[model samples]
Target: MSRIQCPRCQRPQSHCLCPLIPCLDSRTRVLLLQHPSEVNHALNTARLAALGLNNAELIVGEVFEDLPRLLNQPGYRARLLFPADDAQPIQTYGASDEPLLLVVPDGTWRKARKILHLNPLLAALPRVTLADGGVSRYRLRKAPGPGALSTVEAIVQALQVLEAPVSFEPLLRPFEALIEGQIAAMGEETFRRNHAGK
Candidate 1:
């Protein structure tokens, strides 16, 4: 027997996350360049982020052949959301008229690096970084270093900086629920032991 999937959020019907997502329209357009490997991860958050946003798009692949045309599209300025040493800190767009096209690469660090290495257009684009985002709320995955954040967390903080804090609050509403659900599944004892000293 096959497991049925939710057409909108693309999770197993029983595990469908659509109901947890909120509809949000954002001034900054999000374009997720996801590595093919991340498409089916059970904990994938990019899909949720895209689903919750009215102005987001997700494209899965290792190499984006249509990047040239995508970056050249009118009405928005394309910017890569990678923290290169020279990358600029994000602004709230308070003084700019152009729409922000945030191009985020979604994958593990290795895969994300490969995406950047293989995509020249992405490498050449102006890069931006989040300077002071607090700890990641995603406890499911271990980050590579201190201050590292999950893709959803990074996007949320970026949105908070690029738009209003309230504008991105809904984007994370479901994320909190998902975490709580996981903890609940683990039950109080296991959860307590895991979080005992934290």
Candidate 2:
């Protein structure tokens, strides 16, 4: 039989990561546009990110029919959190400046691009990229390249940058625990052989 899972975090009851998840608040709202394929993946980091933040939402689909309404959050300017040649670096905001509605595409590089391809309005938003040198802690998958990060890690880094002096580290606790759990399940020898160095 399948193991019982927590309704919230989706991990099996014995290994539920809800306790480690935080409900941190952020000035910058996060909107995770996840591809359907990622919803059932073992490491659904985008779901974790959505749960950890008070100002976040996770929507799973390819073509978002309500794109206009979704991006029309008041008192915030929406920006796509994807790297591009013309993408602007996310920066700390002043007290009086309007905060960002950070719309992130949660999927593999190709899937994320496909989401953009299907939703032109989402793709047309002002783009924002994280600063360089961030690395992925997600060991089970081969990263697309250096500086690649899991969805949660990218959100953490982006929040840290946009809300300077405020730490988003708490949001990473559940993610870290999840990684450890995955590594343990796979056995140290296997992890060392396959994912440790990359």
Candidate 3:
């Protein structure tokens, strides 16, 4: 039989991550647009991000029919957190500037692109990207390229930049714990042989 799982974190009860998830506030709002396929993945990092931050929401689907409502929060400008040649690098904000409603697409690169294709409004948002050289902490899957980060990692990095002077490190606690749990289950020898050197 399948192990009983926590309704919130979706981890088996024994491994529930609820306790480690933070309830921190942020000046910038985060909206995670997740592809349906990622919901059941072992390390659902997007879910972790949603749970940790006070001003965050996660909506999973192929095409979001409510794009306008989702993007229209007052006092914030919606910006896609995806990379592009002309994408602006996210930076710390000043009191005079409006805060950002950071809309993040969460999935494999191909799936994420599909979401953008299906949601035209999401595609049209001004794009902002994390600086080059931010590394991925996800060990199980090989990153498609350098500077690739899991959803939660990307959110943490973006928040670190957009709200500098406020530490977002607490947001990473459950993510680190999840990675350790995955490594433990796979056996040290197997991890070393396959993923350690990457």
How many clashes in each structure? 0, 0, 0
Tens-digit lDDT string for candidate 2 (96-164) = 989999999999999999999999999899999998998887878888887799999999999999998
**For candidate 1, lDDT tens digit of each residue in 1-198?**
989988887777877777779888888899999999999887678888898888999999989999998787689999999888889999878665797899999999899999999998898999999976368887755667777887888898899888865568777877777777777778978977776435
Sorted by TM-score, highest first, which candidate order results?
A: 3, 2, 1
**After superposition, which runs of candidate 1 have C-alpha atoms over 4 Å from their true positions?**
191-198
What's the CA RMSD for each of the models? 1.9, 0.8, 0.6
TM-score of each: 0.91, 0.98, 0.99
Candidate 2 ranges beyond 4 A from true positions: none
In terms of TM-score, how similar is model 3 to the real structure? 0.99
Which structure among the candidates has the greatest TM-score?
3
Candidate 3's displacement at residue 21, Å, is: 0.5
Which is better, 1 or 3, measured by lDDT?
3
lDDT of 3 by residue, 87-144 (tens): 9999999879899999999999999999999999999999999999988888888999
Model 1 TM-score is: 0.91
